[model samples]
Target: MPSQQDDADPVDTSVAHPARRYDYLLGGKDNFEADRESARLIAERMPTIRLVAQENRWFLHRVVRFLAERGIRQFLDIGTGIPTSPNTHQIAQDVDPTARIVYVDNDPLVLAHARALLTGDPLGDTAYLQADLREPRKILDDPQLRQVLDFSEPVGLLLIAVLHFIRDDDDPKQIVDTLVSALPEGSFVAATHVTLEYMSPEQFAAVRARAEHQSAVRSGAELTALFEHPRLQVVEPGAQSVSRWWPDEAPQPRPSIEDVACNGILARVGPRSA
Candidate 1:
């Protein structure tokens, strides 16, 4: 919450941004006609789009709370879409009042709504930066970010619903490796992405076709390789449907391919290698 002045441009209003479309799904008013149109079209084909969004948000909340309870103090959340109730800082700071978090997103609206994300306990610090994930180094080296996060110590790296925006040629795995390599060994990584794991070849083909016309969706193996630290171990119920990971109560597993298109997981960076 550094800049109070109208120092930056609002997020683009012309083309539909995935973040805005997601906001529409979450029923926020910050979205535009283009965003709503895209969301509506996709939802027409998939009626449960809003449910998926809610489930993903719940997954984020649960993971942040779990990590905070385990004593993590610093977090770097990339692709943090428009802020909603119980955002990352909310969950973490609730557990540890002194927790520090840095939220990064390319969407200008995300920066426009920085005030919401910066609301942290007086003891803890929260910062929102307008940056792209392709430039992870500049973000890590940012002065405000440096003020709040200590790279030499453990930090939670979150990449939820964002990696699909990056294509295979972007070397998403390398990006993760570079970021993870910079963190101390005890750090952790939490990630989620749209996948077509539970669909038939034809069914998956149809799903993929739909997503191709709209968003980026990856396969399970491709997502798993994104976190390839020899030392890191995935938490229980690893990379299953988001509903299955540490659910407060068991969710009836989705019985059909259309029921699940997103997968979520949490992995602890191995304690500093001996």
Candidate 2:
């Protein structure tokens, strides 16, 4: 696993954290009451919080497998929440035993679990880094990441469901540019973000205020701008609802069109393949 501080600050349970809140939404057991409450309130307004999360994870899995199948062996997964089953390392390594992964997250609770449970394939490697999304350079510069990955080769840069926590003031586009610029062309960028376009303006406002009161989330246009750069080429279904992004096994579409709340995409970081 990636290294940790000898005396890192203990987890702060008094306030709800984005990672723990997400874990709560995903029905994971690693969250506190505060996190659950926040998730519940969000669900009260948007009943499909759990379903949206699952859909995003499904997209992550399919994107990883798709990228791994294309011969990319290095992965940089940011905002890696609690060590959910079939993690990025597990998925990538399954396709190629030598696939290397570096998981990054700023949450102390997620870090604690990651430090205790990250396991890599015998032929490959996996490491966890505790770092904030705002500090893309820190993650892109981590020695552990450098040791396991070569920027000169193609790599997968993932920011699933984490960018929403970054407000417009944070200049998410700049952060993304910094990370993607560090990798070679042929690399891929897969991201999932929360949005409000699915709801009526009134419903959107209600939930928007709710998310802002607890956690910072963004709009669809804002998320699209995160991928703004001439070097990247969005894949076929660019930035669609997570449920509609290349669904394999063709999950039965929800009975209603109003079943999703998250937007995501899997784009490549190179000239379009002819």
RMSD of each: 2.5, 2.4
Q: What are the per-residue Cα lDDT tens digits for candidate 1 across 194-223?
A: 887765676566567778765568776677
lDDT of 2 by residue, 69-92 (tens): 999999999999998888999999
Off by over 4 Å in 1: 1-6, 200-203, 213-215, 249-258, 271-274
Error of 1 at 29 (Å): 1.3
For each candidate in turn, the TM-score is 0.90, 0.93
